[model samples]
Target: MTDGDARLTDICSGAAGGKMATIAEYYAGKNVLITGATGFMGKVLVEKLLRSCPEVKALYLLVRPKAGQSMQQRVSDMMTCKLFDRVREDNPDFHQKIIPISSELVQPGLAISPEDVEKLSGCINIVFHCAATIRFDEPLKHALQLNVIATQQLLSLAKQMHHLEAFIHISTAYANCNRKYIDEVIYPPPVEPKKLIDSLEWMDDGIVRDITPRLIGDRPNTYTYTKALAEFVVQQEQDKLNIGIIRPSIVGASWQEPFPGWIDNFNGPSGVFIAAGKGILRTMRANNDAVADLIPVDVVINLTLAAGWYTAVHRPKSALVYNCTTGGINPFHWGEIEHHVMSSFKRNPLEQAFRRPNANITSNYLINQYWILVSHKFPALIYDLFLRLSGQKPQMMRIFNRLHKAISLLEYFSSQDWEWNSENLSMLMSQLTPEDRKVGRPTKHAARLGQIFNILQLTYEPDC
Candidate 1:
């Protein structure tokens, strides 16, 4: 067999042993820095590192004060969220290890003070960059500021870190959405990063909005465009820094660790699944057969830590890129997702559901709109009428309308799939010990199916 075939076979076999031990061993006693710790994936990465690698030195989290809260207060509240229940149980004082630094990525030099920089440069061993603007409708200038410029600044800091072992940048699999098949290697960005940043600096928001369609060309939005540019910027550090990139497709709920079906935000498929499960969304435009590419958060985090280990240990001449996706290994279609989501909700029904969880995806726009009126609007209207007759406020229809709007914004991802080469992911897995593989196998595919079944059972349960 060829080396590639041998690597594939090893990964398939390692699936039985799990991969957590190697990851745990690698992160032990390492001082790590993470950005975007308050976001979905970032939170998971922080929790997993603390829970699985408890001996790690410390975790420096860059956080900006929001609303009226101080940086310390925000980080404290974030740790108390339900998402950290597992970690709390395992290590009751896990929050003590998280050092919150007041730094805003959009600010000049990412707003990191000289003292904080000195501290990081002296002690930090690894950095995970997970911060990015995921908004599909974010203004071009704002997205570029957060995604592209922030990355450039972070690379400069990484260069200054005397003890830095690896720098992992979390990028989206859809960064190169214009192409159907995406390889592990970096592609030349559509526009030069500096040129785009300079042009947007002088343009007004209205002007940027007006020309966004033309500027993006075949790509759908500014989010992907900025992400692609960020990848290019990260690649520039390959010669001097031990860098790795993890491009995960649409991130979803936890498949195994912590708990099954644990999701917090209303982005990507999570919003649609929750909206549909609540019986609020009835029709959406999507290709049933298109690969959904929905990866579990735990799987992505696992691959990320593994990549960090590989970059630090191997120090390869080329920057490693790991396509953390499921399509190539276990292809699942939107049609199946729709079926499972509806079934799950039917069993574990939401607090207040609309007409049973009966949403459908379609390719034809007209058909979808027709169902939106008949299946969605009509039921909501009838439900509102009943509530009005009972002297109650009519609110169900309004909520369904908002849900429909949210789903409409997310259909673009569901209607298409991007193929990613994961050769590096395979290589990283190969370097793990047999014991490590046993703990990080990700429950295989059975756990995912079981979670869907449990969701269905909960939705339809009479008491629920």
Candidate 2:
């Protein structure tokens, strides 16, 4: 076989049940490059690396200028965030290790200057590809631009790194939602990426939007469709690169590491939790029996860092796919998440709730619609009328409209169950250092973790 087609060598010398090099030890003095360092997961990975692996040489962050702030200012502000508070307390000078590089993922060559490119290509030992548009409603063109095309570009840049040992690409467990059972392997892309890319290059945004539904086929959204394509794109270079892919399901709040119930945004379950807490959301459509598959952010981060070390040290024969999920191990369900969230909020209670904190989920469409009309629309209409009578701007109806749209997107995942084969998670966990393995157990945190999936119902977030 040619070099590109060479399969894995399976260096199973100590592949299982052996004391291996600690994650921190392996990261010592390594020059790591990270994209999306300002994002939720990116920030946690940086802090974990700094706190857990203090001897690491430096962290190069690829950042784009945003919202009237330079990349440096953005990184600086990111350091002051509450999420990094623990790292700050541990090492007051932790900010020194972060070096922000000016770059834009959507632009050509990632908008990196020749000087920055040279610096990264010469010294960077590993790369964490974490940046992507996670919005479920993103247009096909925009989603493909960031999720697939940008990934291909990053891999090209990884090819240029003279010392690069591992490339860890963060993907979602729902990328292959079209399939009911997901394995720890890259499935064939729905269509040839080159063909899709070339065909769309000449089309305008309007044309792409019209054909998106037909093109995406069984996938629920453009985000998943493009992400699945990205995995394939990454796999094409496995023969030449030491690569690891992390597929985490419904990533929720931190379970233990960094702290419990630490979530920054109102995306995902966080919104639903917050909305229900405020007594605004009283009903949702979800299967009472479907597995929630909530993986904590810290757990995902730990798995990611460990995967990086494994890919570099063992030099996996081909790309390794870690299905970082709770499906097989803990198997928490949507009904449980709903029960705990409502209980937590009812016990503590949100201040100034519109009504009382009472929410329920059902699987039947007619029953859900009846409750939505009674518990959601009617209340919102009355509240809006009250506001109008009081001379305040009428808004509750508009809020409900947005909430309906948001939950409509979420119900697809919540109302059904997908069997995610997470044997790879166990395989990788067995190889981790004993200390790392202790804090990263799924069953260990299940008690509290079952309640911390705060999916916001009404919080308007850009990434929603």
- Candidate 2's residue-wise lDDT over 1-464, tens digit each? 32211110011112233566656767889999999888878887887888777889999999999989999998898887767777798789999999999999999999999999999999999999999999989999889989999999999999999999999999999999999999999999999998999999999999999999999999999999999999999999999999999998888767655555666677777778778889988999999899887877877898898889889989989999998877777777888788888877877787899889899999999999999999999988898989999999999989889989999989999999999887877787677544345445545365354345333221222231
Question: What's the lDDT for residue 167 in model 2?
Answer: 100
Per-model C-alpha lDDT, please? 0.80, 0.83
Looking at model 2, residue 309 earns an lDDT score of 87
Residue by residue across 196-284, what tens digits does model 1's lDDT show?
A: 98898998989999988898898888899899999999999899999999999887777655555666666777667777877778789
Candidate 2 has a TM-score of: 0.93
Runs in model 2 lying further than 4 Å from the true structure: 1-20, 444-464
Which candidate leads in TM-score?
Answer: 2
